[model samples]
Target: MEELDEDNMNEIKDKHEIGTPEDHLSEIMEEAEKYHPGYGASVMTGDVLIHALEIKTTSFCTLRCKDCTHLIPYTKAPAHMPAEDLMDDIKKIIRVAKVAGLIFMGGEVMIYPQLAELMEAYSKEGFYDRVGFVRVTTNGTVVPSDEFCAAFRKIKNGYVVISDYGILSSNRDEAAKKLESFGIKVNVIPEDLQWRSLGDWHHRDYSKEEAEELYRKCHGKLYLHLYRDHLYHCYRAPVMNEDGLIPHSDGDYLDIGSMSVEDLSRRLPEFLTGLSCTKSCFYCDGFHEQSPFVERAAQL
Candidate 1:
């Protein structure tokens, strides 16, 4: 093992910060338009009836799915959001942005003991009905207790969205049935796609051909919501990965209330014009998909 000196350590840290800089907001926005038309602009304008606000409840997962893209591999222990802080942020978003819904996502939200408390807080605030809907995206491994389910049942608009990997242990069907028994709407994402490993990240790779096939099978479309001061139409995964977890335009976590629809719309052209550098753009699926720059660069 070679010893790493102080200078060597600093260089490694710097490299990680610039882990993938060529990946820029402009390129992502352009790719958004190409892969999913009108999605970018719709999110910016809030024309879509539903808007998602995700609170990562627990940062750790009991099961290790190969293509886990939440960057869970980088840390040993997952972080949990304090219920108080989580509720405060939720209230603020609802009051300021007129958001339609809230999504609780995580390594596993059910595993967080305080999840029931957090949900109850929303109901107590009288924002429950106005909340439009509450959805939880989980890996479908841990089954919530009867008491937990009872609490979730109290929220009239609550539901669960379970992602089914092909692994049998996920027991997605059983989980959905159980949640439905409690009068909660259960949406199961079937395991139609195979998981592929990309370096340390595991993802469901839908090649252009595979994606088209999957679209037909699911009878739906893939959409992305890019959130800065507000949401922008996007596939969510790639743009957030490119922005390095902080909102690029304002150097803050995305705060929906602070943004205007017009401001988000105007940024689109700027994003398109800035996609010349190709370093960070390499990992994106949009690279292969058709786009204005892709056509122009091909000519050059």
Candidate 2:
């Protein structure tokens, strides 16, 4: 997928000198039709194709990192969705959409009890073609069970992204070794890696124009977070809503469980590409070039 073109967006902003929030939203959505990460119009006309899907299997983490991007620490009542619960949405998504990657993520996916069962569900039964590569992202706090390893090996196109946070993630190496032993691919991110501060749950107080501009500047558009059964343009939507930090807004996300596959195909592009910015955007510092960098995995 191509990155957002700041220059093109700037030209539109400069040329139109858009005034009203409603008007600017309309203009932005119209411009979004041209080209952007989630701006695939083919789903409306031809095929339902999604570049990627980040599925949150669990919100329960072992450590409480102060600057966690997903805001995992803030969730008062974190959850762990069973494989069976997730499979329904998985089945619904793959039914109409050709997903490039099926990413299973969490506060710490390694701790998710049904990891093995989830892996088997996506990797087998001709689901490979529908859902391209499967990925399991972990914080490397714990090693996987033998059953999980066996299931992971069955994935035709799958790998693990394990973050190594020095002493915090002592089992990082051992976990990778275990997965590799099962012939499962692994990518271990360095402990000292930099992280952008996603800020606390508060209103940014940006005006309509500024809010739209902030959305344009953000790079998180590609990080389409599927929380529970709801699909959101921003990854923080789930956390913000779950924690009651933000007001409820229907336009912010799609309730995928209630919608049909055809409804999803119709709304997916609109939801992903059409939105100027979600309410959660006001609370997030965002991941972008101009954003401030911070230390990684500083536990509270």
Candidate 3:
């Protein structure tokens, strides 16, 4: 694997300037020779392929829980990603990949100002038709405004995934009620939940074999993140990188905004799935099969 210098990393970040999901879906569909029943396209990244894409809108949340998979609570400063930036990545992904589901999430998804507009864009592109479901994961604490709720109703197939924190959420019921009233399905994650220490939130070293084994057992590895211009195999990388908890390398992610489907298909899986583990793994708790039950949404 080649080492990525700081200059190259910066350049990669600034490279994207074109395309949208709607614009390229037709081209991708042509190249997508195989298709799953509910999943949209059939494209390959090396030998590995995915039917789902996880879209993380922001790292800023309303509550500061101790254990966040996203490592958002540990961020020194969290902010909502610009809606325009997020839409750009979504466009690039839909162009190159066929997806069965799209998970829209954030620090607190309700707080994003463009929540309604984002949903609208996805729907306008007929994104809902391509996937089994389009879900927005939320803490169930913020009751969305009229506009946001309206967007949910309009999408028809959109779902509200609520992580109910029991006593921690003063508005959980209200929020669910509002969403349900709009005829949106509410998927609830009860307060009683399993908790695992993702990591010590510090760096550690591991051999390639060990890291690969860890990745196999890790759940975060399943939900590859599409944020900014990069596609990350694990959701942990961006937040951990932002907090200076892990070193950033080109090997750690794919610059989806810059690379063509041919280029990504040939090279992505080598560094993405071939790696033993990510730099974030050193700081992460690795995996605990029997994650203990803990208080949901307990504050620091």
Candidate 4:
């Protein structure tokens, strides 16, 4: 290959920079229309199926990891989400698609009081059979009660996913053993595994096309979330919205409670793959895995 001069290199790098915010927004709107067509003209729910659905059961976290995607430390006060409302949302979701699994998450899911009850109720409603997997994510801070373990065991493919934060977490091993003793499956994400920053407080500088390319390459794009009765298309949108980092307006998510099942089907693909980037993407680091992995959950 021929060598590129300094000027050529600079020119190539410049191609990636996003223009002014006004211009960027204009580009996004134009591209959204191209891919999604009618842009926000109607509610068209139909045959949209989602693979994994995330439920934030609580916003309380015992450990404050400096780089939490959920922005838990920024929370003014911890709050428990009523399990009844969550069940109602899940009911709305299953009507749209055959979800492969449900991910119960939080600042730390174990801290949620209604966890066992929610798991048992979802299991009784045939969610275990319908989705095939039920995963509860925890930061390894607290040990779960025996009643919780019993409820987890009742699901056909239920498991606990412990984020092993090394020195920061005291009870990881104990919690895993406790669940396994009750015949529940446990999967531990060791401290060594790499977690690429979903954009650490700054968005990647990218042209509209470049941002779309990054969105296509992101695995986390599939990790959709449901909160406050709305269905979001990705993991970042809902949490970042709570942080006041992005507009939580109607354009950001689907109102699952009111939209008809057919309307949801028609709109699902557009939400999933239509947009170039949310305004939040500018505040994020984008999915650059080449960035070195920091120690998991370093204290804030």
Model 1 lDDT at residue 46? 38
User: Candidate order by TM-score, highest to lowest?
Assistant: 2, 3, 4, 1
Q: Candidate 2 regions off by >4 Å?
A: 1-45
User: Which candidate, 3 or 4, would have the higher TM-score against the true structure?
Assistant: 3
Candidate scoring better on lDDT of 2 and 4: 2
Which candidate leads in lDDT? 2
Segments of candidate 4 deviating more than 4 angstroms: 1-47, 202-206, 257-263
Q: State the C-alpha lDDT per candidate.
A: 0.48, 0.73, 0.66, 0.68
By summed lDDT, the worst window of 10 consecutive residues in model 4 runs over: 35-44
Please give the range of 10 consecutive residues that has the lowest summed lDDT in model 1: 291-300
Kindly list the per-residue Cα lDDT of model 3 for residues 1-300, writing each as its tens digit: 122354644454333221332333343333222222323333334324444468878777889877676777877667777777777777656555545556889889998888888877766776644455567889877998888887777765567888888866778899989888888878788765434446546665667676666666666665678766678877777777655666665666788778766776676557444766776666665543423323345576
Using Cα atoms with residue i matched to residue i, what is each candidate's TM-score against the true structure?
A: 0.54, 0.82, 0.78, 0.77
Task: Name the weakest run of 10 consecutive residues (lDDT summed) in model 3.
Answer: 29-38
Tens digits of per-residue lDDT, candidate 2, 132-159, equal 4577888888998898999888876678
